[model samples]
Target: MPQRLVAVSFNAPTSELAGRVTGQGATLRDIPGTLFLGGGVPVAVDGTSIAGIGVGGAPSGDLDEKYARAGLATIR
Candidate 1:
C-alpha cells in the first residue's frame, strides 16, 4: 500500500483519493504504473513537483494525506 501511495504521489497531479485518479479505472491497479490510490502527495516547490511523499497505516486516506502534507511542510 505504501508503494502504491508513493507511485501515485509521484505520477499523478493529485492523489486518487484526492479525486484525481490517473489512467483508466481498471488500469489503475496496474503495477509499474501510477497506482492512483491515496495517502500520498507530491512535494512541490514554486508549484512544480520535485519529489513525493506517502503515508500508510493512518485511520483514513484524509489523515494519511494530511500527514504527507505535514512532512512536506518541514522541507518547504
Candidate 2:
C-alpha cells in the first residue's frame, strides 16, 4: 500500500518541542518538501508508521497534540 500524507493547515505552534519534532521527522525519511510540526504524529502499527495525524489552530502545540492523539485513540 502507498503511504498517505494529510495536510490540514500550516499554522502549528512554534516552540522548542516543535523544533525537535520537526527535526526528528525530517531526518526519519529525509524526504524533500516535507513538513514536520509539533502537532503531527505518526500512527505506528507493529512498529511501522502506517499513517499520521496533524492538528493545528490550537492555542499551543501540546493542545494540538492532545487532539491529534485523541483522534488516534479512537482508531486504535
In order of appearance, the predictions have TM-scores of: 0.58, 0.56
Per-residue lDDT over 3-73 for candidate 2, one digit per residue giving the tens place of the 0 to 100 score: 11422222222222234444434442355555444566567767666666777789866787778778879
- lDDT at 45 for candidate 2? 68
Output the number of the TM-score-best candidate. Answer: 1
In angstroms, give how far residue 10 of model 2 lies from its true place: 18
List per-candidate RMSD values in Å. 4.0, 7.5
Global local distance difference test of model 2: 0.53
Q: What lDDT is reached at residue 14 by model 2?
A: 25
Off by over 4 Å in 2: 1-36
Instruction: Give the Å shift of residue 13 in candidate 1.
Output: 6.0
Local accuracy by lDDT, each model:
0.59, 0.53
